[model samples]
Structures are given as structure tokens and as C-alpha cells.
Target: VSLQELMEPEAGTNRTAVAEFTLLGLVETEEMQSVVFVLFLFAYLVTVGGNLSILAAILVEPKLHTPMCFFLGNVSVLDVGCITVTVPAMLSHLLSHRPTISYGACLTQLFFFHLLAGMDCFLLTAMAYDRFLAICRPLTYSIHMSQTVQRMLVAVSWTCAFTNALTHTIALTTLNFCGPKEVNHFYQLSCSSTQLNELLLFALGFLMVGAPVVLIIASYIHVAAAVLQIRSAEGRKKAFSTCGSHLTVVFLFCGTGIFNYMRLGSEEASEKDKGVGVFNTVINPMLNPLIYSLRNTDVQGALWRILVGRWSLT
Candidate 1:
């Protein structure tokens, strides 16, 4: 049956509340669905395994017990959460004939997705701050980034993320969803005017998204100035190397995120934009652990030692 037929009210019934939403899976063709499902399933496994490996390394490797690694571990957890919220459901829906999600479940998914994603943005900013202290203010780094201070930063990031997610969820619930239970793109289903939602999005885009990018940029500015003042070429390279992985991650995550969120005011996202969404949600999570492990000798050495130790034992 067509989506319109599914949405139409039964005879003698008036417009009713939306109890569930139909999902337009990534592809319509069965053959394409199978291929896409395999690809995404592989990507999901890699993302989970790679992040778990990073977390495991952080736990077993004493060298990774620093403030930076602590933040990285939290980020790994968030990355896993970020992908798990949507991907698994999407995978299941890909195979089902009538793929649908209940109204409550849909909102719950929305809430957690935003929460984890917002936490990622804040955590990256915190990481940039940590790098700033370590590189620009070396002597005071230990004092400023104490274990207690590190915990506080994490707490603040999560609290801010929770608040933002809650606000968005509440605002969405206030909207009246009268018909058309199909969710094709972003959460743009509302019978009422979305002016309030748009305003909140624009305002919080600055607070939650734009603000972090600004802070990250400012932190790197100081870091760049400090690294330039280094006398030896090796010293400068080392400084840049420490941040290179993080910079790459930040660009990959935030760049696509900004592109997606900034264009929400438009009537609908283009297919190209949806492709960017796939890259952001699926491809980016899988890349983070690889980027860090490949770039950082500490992570590589730790992973290598763990592997060799297990090998010798076996």
C-alpha cells in the first residue's frame, strides 16, 4: 500500500494522533537493500570493535591513563552510542516489508541521538582545551588538567548535552503531528508551525555547535603560536603530530554535522546531503579509532604490546 493510503484515516474517523512512523529505508530495491545492508553491517561491526579496542587499550595500558586518554575513552563510548542509536534499527528496517517505529520509540531515539552527538561536540572542545594546556602551557598542564578537573570537564559536557537534548525533545513533543507518519529525512514532521523549533535550532546551533568550533579554533590558535616558538624542527613536528589526529577527527565530524544542521531550515535535504549524512553517521565513527591509533605511537605501541603478549601466551 502507498504511504498516503497508510496515513489516511479510516471511515468515520477524524484526524488522529500519530502513533507510529513508517521509515523509508535507504534503498527501495531488494537487491540494493541487501548490498547496502552488508556494507553497513560491516561498517557497524568495525566501528564497535575498533572503539572497543581503543577502550581496552586505554584500560590495560598505563601510558594511556592520562587526562587526554580519559577523554578519548569517553569519546569512544559516545561514538559507539552515537552509531548504535540509529544504525541497528535502520539495519532491521532494511529487511522488513513494513518498516515502522512507534511514536514514543522514535522520540526516544531522537533524544539519545542528540544527547550523544552533542556530547561528542563538547568533548572535542574539551580535548582541544586539554591540548592547548599541554602544548601552550606545558608547565601548568599537570595542575590545570588534574584528575578532578578532568572529571569536572566531562561532567559539564554531559550536563550541557543532556539539557540541550531534553529541550529539543520537549519542543518536538509540543508540535501537533496530524498526518503522514513517514519519516524520510530529518525530524521535520509537524502539522503546526515550526518557527519555535527553528529558532531553538538556530540559537542552540550557536550554543552547542558554533560555540565549540569557536573554542576549538581559539585553542588551536594558541597551540599554533606556541609550537611555532619551538626552537627545533623535531619539537615543532611533535607538537603538530599530537594534534593532527584530533584535527582530522574534528573536521570529519563537525564539518558534515554543520552542513546537515545548518540546512535544516530548508524544506527538504537533497539526496547529496543524505549521502553526507551516511558518511557522518556511518563512515566517520569507523574512522576515529583508526585515525588515532595510526597517528599516535602511544596507542600503536600499546596495541602492539597487547597483541604480542597474547600471542606469546597462546
Candidate 2:
């Protein structure tokens, strides 16, 4: 159905129907817009290329076929999706004098963006649990994190993410707009009361962001405890090192995501918020592959094999 059908006012209501939304994207001045556009374009390219390389390395290398690597591949795909949903459109808008997006396009972007973002949280929590099992219960790690279990975790993550994104998108569609439909980080375009939307966002944000964060924290707590019980300092260090890349990514993603979503009461997007948005949307995705590659010997070796023509599906 069309956006008009979805977003039409009630029969008695006198609200203006919003056909499109003006995107006051990060910068205002032409000079700054050009500079931001170039930087974002470069960042987008790097993010896509880096994530693709990670996916290839995981697929090509037998050594990197563990549950951790499986989840890493999923993360790479989500990172690519997350960046793609927003950056390309933003880049095109940067070039336009009037950077407006149709109501349908805006909602579509919101759906995919939130879907992937929610998956990021759930997948990270899954990865954290994988690490916890490997470190804390090594004897049962293989049994608990079998191929079947891994796929189930991924399936659940995707299901939950789709539900969360769809809920928000549907909630937004129920609101009626009067005027001044400007979308910045999030669309607050409705002249109608957004109390339901805010409440819904807060509730699902807790489920998608807060609960996963708590689980991640709990998993790491157990992991730390298990690592500390190791007799050798080298063994403890080695155990903790396994978590390095995942921990870094968790901090970067959860930090910005919590700041952006948790404060549903705020209406104004500050400079700090925009900067955080850029980092979350663009910089963070590019860093994921780098973090995994540099910090992970298996991924590095897999990439090296591909680079040197030794990689084979066999």
C-alpha cells in the first residue's frame, strides 16, 4: 500500500498529509557539505570493502569456521547492511540542493536501519555467549555451540530484529503529520502525540539494546572469572585476548546506540548526537573488519591465504 493510505488522517481530523520529509542531514553550508560528502563517501567504500573481505576470508578459510567466525560473518553482513541503508542516500542528498525523501523511502530506510541495528545487538550478545562458553566451559563448548545451536541463535536474532523494526515502522505509520516534517537522526515528524511511539521505542529499545547489553555484561563477567582462575599469566592473557575484538566492537556499538535510542524524550539533535550518529553509522562498520582482522590471527591468516592465492574452497 502507498504511504498516503498508511498515513492518512482520520475522517474528522484536519491534519496536513505529509508526502515527503526534508532531511537536514549532518551539515548545512555548501563547503562543509562537500567535505562531509567526500569523507562519508570514502568511509562508505571502506566499510563495504572491509566487511566483504571479512566475509570472503571466513568463507574461504577452514580454520575460521568456528562458531565465532560464523557469527563474525553475520556481523560483517549486518555492518554492510547498516551502512548501506543510510550512507548512500545521505551522499546523494549531500549533492542535492533540496534533500527531501519520500515518506515511503524514509520509512523503508528506518525499517532496514533498525532491523540491522537490532541484529547487531543480538548477534553481539550471541558472540559474547559463545566466548563465555569457550572460555568458561571449554569442555562443553563444542556440545553447546554446535552448528545447529549457532544457526538457531542467528535465526532468533533475525526474527527479533525484524519484529522490532516492523513494530517501530508500523507505529510511525499510525501518526498524522500537520507540517514541518524534518528528519534528522530519527523522524519526529508527527504533529500528533508521539507518546505511544516514544513508549514503544523505549520498551523495544530495552529489549533490543538494554537486555542484550545486560546479557553481554553477564557473559563477560563469567568469562573474566574463568580467565582469572587460569594458573599461568600467559594463559589468562591468552584467554582474555580472545575477547578483545568482540569487546571493542561491543563498546563502540552499544555506547552510541544506547545514547541515541535510550533518550527517547529528547527532541533536539545536538552536534554531539550527530557526531555519534556518524561514528555509529559509518566509522563503526569500517572498524569491525579491521578489529577482527588485526586482532584475530585466524582471520589474518585466512586473508593472507587469499592474498597469496593459496585460498581454496577445498
Candidate 3:
């Protein structure tokens, strides 16, 4: 049997299976290409440097050895993995103007992209829970979020993200891309039409993405309620201060995700839609570490200490 026959058993006619796909990159202007290349290159470097520095600070600093920092470390790792999947290839495509990506590489990129994104969602919800427990149940927080329990939570987050990505990968593998080999976005692996794969993607989004968003919303609701219960002005101010940074990060990440994937099956998407999609995938990962570091006093202090220590040794 031919590859097309193998892919589509019910089809009465035969067709050619697409072996390669062309990615339509962000812009086609020759003058703009060089400018975009330099700008994206700078963004990519800052992304890698900021995330790695955060990870290093968390690891080397004893003061940051807490559940929150542990989760932050995982977020940093996810950010690095997320950006690495798309930015380098995107940069290459921008510079070379040859937008061909192999089937295997495309799939690999899609897999890691979804994996890291799902992991970030899970981790953010986990962080919200951590903050909730710290504020609401101060005395029992340590007991509830013990080392073993925290480790288990992190492990479960990774496992669920991997499984979610695997489901999509398997679904895509079953699809037969027989025509329209040009992908109208920066990536090609996401364009295949396997009903099973799309359904799986929707299912994973509902369970992993939808569920966590609900939990995050519920968490902040409770957090807001708790903050309101505080009678003293000082107490309310402190509570709000504690939550402001996390709330900002959560809104930025989840807002983009909801805008991108929530409208996936809709017919309203256009080239501007794809541009927004690319923005979330490429820019958000870079922004996460910067937002956390610049806004969170704990992270900033840890980063400063690390810098000072390094300078002293040199």
C-alpha cells in the first residue's frame, strides 16, 4: 500500500503525501528583515541570559531555598526551553530567508513548545496555591507544603505537561498532510489536519489549560477576599504588595494563552491573529523572568547578592 493509503484507509482515491513544508515567516520586506534580525537577536540573548541568571541565583542562594523559589526555578527552566524551541530557528529563517524546516524538526519543536507551555500553566497554578496557603494558613503552611509534597507537585506538573504534549504528537503523527505544504505561520508542524489530533489538542487544553486557569482564578478570588478581610491599613497594604507581582505575571502569561489557544477553532483568525500568536510564543517567555526579577523584591535581592558575590571573587 502507498503512504497515502496507509494514512487514509477510507479514501476512495489516492493522493500524494507531503514530505516537507515551507514556513511563511513574520515579514517579507528586505529592508525590515535586517532590523528585525538584530532586534530579535538582542531579545533572544536577554531571554537566555535573564532566565539562566535567575536559575543560577535560585540554586546558589540559600535565602531563596523555599517553595516559591523552587517553583520560580522550574519556571525559569521552562522559559529557557520554551524560547529555545522557536527563537533560534526563527532567527535563522529571518536571516537566511530560507524557511524550510524538516518534518522531524517541526514535530520536535511543537512537542517542546506545548510541553513547556503546559508546564508553565501548571507551575503558575501551583505557585498560586503556595501563595494562598502562605497567606491563609500561615501556621500550617510548612506542614502542608512539605519538601516531599512540593517535589511531588513539581513531578506531577512535568508528567502532566509531557503527557499532554505526547497526546498531541501522537494525534499529529496519524494525520496525512497530502496538500497545501506551505504553513502560514512561523512553524509548520501545527498545520496538519488530523481530526483526532485536533480533538486531543482541544481535550488537553480543556483539562490542563482550562482547569488550571479556573484554579488560578479561584485562588486569586480567595486571595482578594482574604486581603479585604484585613482591618488595618498596614495589613491590607502588605497583603496586596505580596500578591501584586505574582498577579502581574499570571495575567500576562494566562492572558496571552487564552487569547491564542482559546480561539483556535474559530474562523475569525487572520494574519494579525497569527502575529499575536507569534508574539505570545516568542515574547512572553522572554518577559517572564524579567517581570519576576524586576517586580519581586526577593528575586531582585537574590540576584544582586549573586552579582556582588561574583564580582568579589573576580
> Largest lDDT belongs to which candidate?
1
Error of 2 at 223 (Å): 0.6
| Candidate 2, superposed: residue stretches over 4 Å from native | 1-13, 179-187, 310-314
- lDDT by residue (1-314, candidate 2, tens digit) is 01112234646766667766666667669999999889989999999999998999999888888999999999999999999998888888887766777888988998999999999999999999999999988899999999999999999999999999999999989987763434345545567899998889888888899899999999999999889889999998888888999999999999988887764456665678778877888899999999989888888988888877844554
TM-score of each: 0.94, 0.92, 0.89
lDDT of each: 0.86, 0.85, 0.77
Cα RMSD of all models vs. native, in order, equals 2.5, 3.9, 4.6
lDDT of 3 by residue, 180-206 (tens): 333343222333555665577677788
Model 1, stretches more than 4 Å misplaced? 1-13, 179-184
Output the lDDT of residue 91, model 3. 85
Instruction: Tell me the tens digit of each residue's lDDT in model 1 across 141-182.
Output: 999999999999999999999999999999999987774455
Worst 10 residues of 1 by lDDT: 1-10
Error of 2 at 301 (Å): 1.3
